[model samples]
Target chain A: MQKQVEIIKANGEREFFDEGKLRASLLRAGAEDSQVEAVLRHISKELEDGMTTDHIYRHAFSVLKDVQNPRAIRRYSLRRALIDLGPTGFPFERFLAKLFASQGFEVKNDQILQGRCVPHEVDLVAYNENKLVMVESKFHNRMGEKSDVKVALYVKARFDDLSEQLFDYGKARPLDEGWLVTNTKFTENAIKFGVCAGLKMVGWNYPEKGSMRDLIEDSRLHPVTCLPSLTKEERELLLNNDMVLCSQILDSQSKLIELGIKREKVTTIAAEAEALCGR
Target chain B: MQKQVEIIKANGEREFFDEGKLRASLLRAGAEDSQVEAVLRHISKELEDGMTTDHIYRHAFSVLKDVQNPRAIRRYSLRRALIDLGPTGFPFERFLAKLFASQGFEVKNDQILQGRCVPHEVDLVAYNENKLVMVESKFHNRMGEKSDVKVALYVKARFDDLSEQLFDYGKARPLDEGWLVTNTKFTENAIKFGVCAGLKMVGWNYPEKGSMRDLIEDSRLHPVTCLPSLTKEERELLLNNDMVLCSQILDSQSKLIELGIKREKVTTIAAEAEALCGR
Candidate 1:
């Protein structure tokens, strides 16, 4: 009987603690007490037997996203939520920027908008051989009709905000193309909207059999900005600093690589380190 | 947009209709409407996005097991609920009984005990060479401490309510055992009480792997009685009269097999069928 009770207590406590762990994760991600409480309450009310912790995290994130200014919460919360949603949207955007750089397109994230009402963070801005492409991403189980309208708005924003002078004067050109990427089948209305807006819609389906990651790689985006110059003494000091930083970064990268994080992402970190240290 | 909306609407409506599938399953199994409705309400309130239709059925059935005298409800309601829960439990029990037969135990289900002040049906009964096991089964996440007391009381009543002759004869022979089986773990205090009362406690975490099906297989309890016999000609006539019914049963068995339902369960069903047909 003691053994039986111990087993039961252990099982119950494990369940209770698992929920607590999720709550702690949310807190660590800087969720407000009220938001955390609300999420936990919703979860408790809806919980049935056999629910996985991952399912709870996804559900909580969805609920949080529905609330206003969810991004103001901890950076990790947003990242964890994106991860829980799988490789899409913001995560995919970051992933694409790195993949494009590795493949050779001059890629920039959070590129400055010169004429916008406010400084806006565009997902990705890629320049290759005087041609520029602006890309936006949407992740959903299935793309609805409204998605096309949303993407069209993004394209219009990009075309209106970026510098037009770059196209004719500088080696780099003003963005001439727009891309909208999604994980599910797009509605016909969305397809027509994309065509009318002069934006390419990349949908992952059985026939296409490609993810946003693949498209980003194919774009061949790389970093084109030149590194700052340094004198001999300054360069030597910087090189020493860079070596130390690079080793540290490499150690972390090695761990990530061992954990099966994409090699392209690790390579991007290495490139950034190399540029900093004049390697 | 219209096509996408149409598909979403269609799938949404289909899910709505299928939502009551568990109620249909219960009604088919002789459960009452009020009982099934109460269970379904508990289930519907717990629904989450991306949950499968089959999950709802299993959940409803698990909840239904806690409701006493489920078959006392209106026949229509019972049938509806059974349909909702799926038509697997009864056959599963039969298979479990057969699997345990070789181990010298006679397993019985839905056995009414009028000896007590309030008549009730036992979910399972196993008579071994040396012991008579009275078993109650509840399929859910966690059985509360009170539920443990209830099982203990039931076991005590069952033992005490036996005829004096039978009790004396059994006493002269060997001691009988009682068991309470649940999908969830028991409270520590409850286990102590059960152990003190000499009743065996079985939970989801039994047999090291927390699978209910596995526990039934490992327990080695069998059916003491066979199905009612039918002549060969009568069996043939019945099969011919309801070929669709026969096929449906076969299909259900095949589906169970596909789901990795225990082989012992399937064999029990086959044995019961053979007995029913006197084959």
Candidate 2:
């Protein structure tokens, strides 16, 4: 019998290390099976009792950087990049709008929708012929900050208020769904409340099938911050110009030229963005 | 017409000074009309454009300390004293339970009640023959921190959940009402949402009637921390021992003795507490 190794999580909780969870995260980042096995082998050699998940992530990231394509390496850094889209949180909302847009929904960011009692400035409102969804984005710049039950509860109430009133998008209709999206995880009670209240929620890694990560990957709407070719300031500038996704950069070549990027540097960035999104 | 004097509020917004508001606050502290006039006169003499409300409060508090009874002085310091009860926030909950109990309600603190879908650990639940109310206390240690719409929304949801299940509190009954109480103020939107959602809310100075301040004053449930006789540590010790109300200390002399107070000092403390509560 093998002894289970203990590891410290980012939120200061200690739990037994799970090899399957690590392998799954690696595989989700599009790492090849052979590369994942090598990474796992190296991780097992370095694993010790009371090691932090941060330490594990850094080790895995370094291994992936060495063995994988820039695309996969960028994908591996998705969580960190999502967090890096913050400090203002506007970019994350724009990113969400784009994510929904990619799924055949006409999205509007920061719309003032009239509720039954008061006006609510919803973060993103996405609608199609079939459904209208109101999303509230809870963006936390710091790690380990989970969207709690209060956020879920308030979002439910806000959506309920809006559901009582009809709004004209393509035609006059009530809100079909309310969604709570965050760049972090949701607390257990928050998830429970969301389920009981019949509100849709998407966090960084919640709900087995379709989380924020799954949706982002499925939509291929990678944030520009994930591009290794651009510096931090360059990425922020693009975000400030409302170009959040990698696809937006491909569409807006003039934004880079306006940001004073040389033609050759622009080509490199465009190529990196294209490769990162596998476009 | 004379230009209105601009005053900076605690939350950093500038507004024209209203002497009537200041006068009402002084009167609420049980200040006599003559004493109130004197305070107002002094305040007016020293008033400057762009003076913070904090400065006005200090001026009023200083005057009240000079001319008012110990009870009035304590009431004048009530808001600050409430904020002082925190950093841990348990004392505030205990204080609230006592406040409700003083009104002939059977109050329990930190009870895990079964909701429709999950169990919720409510802060204070107060029940009488006619009414059962669940309270969620938002205790902020910092000034200018208000219990916002999110809090009211969650409390309403939580209470609604509990409303689905009957509780054995004297008799089997569902929750009759949900109240959101704060030691501070409520944001405008929070108040609107609370009203729209049918959630009863009590803040330090809200509703124009029957607020937390009104209830505290009417009940004379002055917290032990408001007693000028006790040192900060001694007050904390009482709070730690669950002797939140000054009336509790009056009922339990042994607690002071256990806290290592001398006989004469105990007499002084008791007398001060008694005078502070006018009991």
Candidate 3:
């Protein structure tokens, strides 16, 4: 019998190697079926007696970078890329507002407004021609961390306070809805509480088919943080300049050059952005 | 040499029992100096090796209840008594508003207003001749629990949201300040954060002599739950009828009788309320 393989986790717990989880992650990143299978089989043979998941991840990542499709590898690291986009959540907030902008919403982030009790800092506020939404983002840098029910309650409670004033003395129409967005997942209880409280949750893989991943995938409004070709300093330069999306990079190619992206790389980035936006 | 006595803490840690800590607590509850020393001595004798903190609490509580001054005993149990004031926090909200009312503020509790992002439920909103303030209450059932920095941050963030609307589109006048009120105490970090953020904090013994206890004692606007004369059913009855403060019972004597407080008890309750409310 083949030896049972053990993989170490971030918290130092050891568990059996989970190929299904890896396969699902690859699929989410836009990996083709054949490539994914070949990569997995290659890693299966390379497994050490007690290798860490980090090592396994690096092995897979190298395979991805070396493989012909850089786009699929970019998509695979999207969650990590989202985390790397932030030391604080300010950059992520800008990225999300820009994503909404791509979807034809006039969006604002980090807006302050009066609630009945106290004032609140809204992470993102979006208004279409018809509806306005208040969004709160619960960001975590860790992979398995979740936004729990307390956060859901907190958001809904604040929303309830603010909505009362909105109806009584609001400038425009009362807000149509409130939203809670997270870079990671929502706890089951959070989802349950959010639904009961009438707050929408946009999280990775949450609500299955219409998750944040699906929304971004459909819109093709990928954040600048997700671009594989851009150097770290170059990405930060664009983010600092308030150009959050790959589309923003294309629109402001000269700005990217000013931020020290070489012209050839800028051309490649534009091609990638165009390819991403096309589908 | 007298053996050093160890007392268990709420979190199940044990430390040397210090009479100064006990004396400070007794003094805070308005216990006379002699009575405080005697009570501490008695508890010191009764304590055995490895006695649990809950056991120590019950012993001390019994001593407080039996000693001469019922009012002082009421002050000692103020935190616990406040917890019993709620089926939810609705009655406590009313009670807090009435306390503010005694301070010459026209106060409203549980009001909903539109914030910039969503509607929020304000616990208490007070308007005096000079200023308007928004208040948030943090109530804890446990004796040692505190309103920590996260709660402070939460309150300040919410206040920032509300104040934005006050600047942009407020009617009459914008709020003058925000205050966080709690039945127990604020953590040191909470106090530090509040001070830096310019949000006022009130709790049992925070802010030195000007604590929540000081405010309550000064105003004599005690919650009906603080009255030992009333049965639990009667307290709940008064709470449900929106008669949260002791003064409310005196103002509505007929309502107390309607809730089945006998005519004699009604007279006693009225006298106590009057005595409590006196300048």
Best by DockQ: 2
Tell me the DockQ of each model, to 2 decimals. 0.00, 0.36, 0.05
**What is candidate 3's lDDT per residue for B1-279, written digit by digit as tens?**
233777666456787765665555445445677776677777887877676554554455456545647666657656556878864767767778878887888887777755554455678888866887889987777668899765876676567656766631134777678899888888786777677768989888888977878887777777777655566787788888888777677678888778777765565455445444433
Q: What is the interface RMSD of each candidate, in Å?
A: 31.9, 1.5, 8.0
For all candidates, what are the clash counts?
Answer: 41, 0, 31
Best by TM-score: 2
Cα error of candidate 2 at position A210, Å: 2.2
Structural similarity to truth (TM-score) of each candidate: 0.24, 0.74, 0.45
- Candidate 2 per-residue C-alpha lDDT over B134-164 given as tens digits, one digit per residue, 9 for 90 to 100: 9898999876898877787677778777788
Q: What would the per-residue lDDT of candidate 2 be over residues A147-266, giving only the tens digit for each residue? A: 988788788878877888888889999899999999989999899989998999889888888998888887888898876556778878889888889888778767788887765456
- Candidate achieving higher TM-score, 1 or 2: 2
What tier of docking accuracy does candidate 1 attain?
incorrect
**Per-prediction TM-score, chain A only?**
0.41, 0.73, 0.70
Choose the strongest candidate by lDDT: 2
lDDT per residue for candidate 3 within A149-200, as digits (tens), equals: 6587668766775776663212466778889999889888678767866898
Candidate 1 wrongly placed segments (more than 4 Å): A1-88, A116-119, A141-146, A161-172, A206-253, A257-279, B1-279
Candidate 1 local lDDT, residue B260: 47
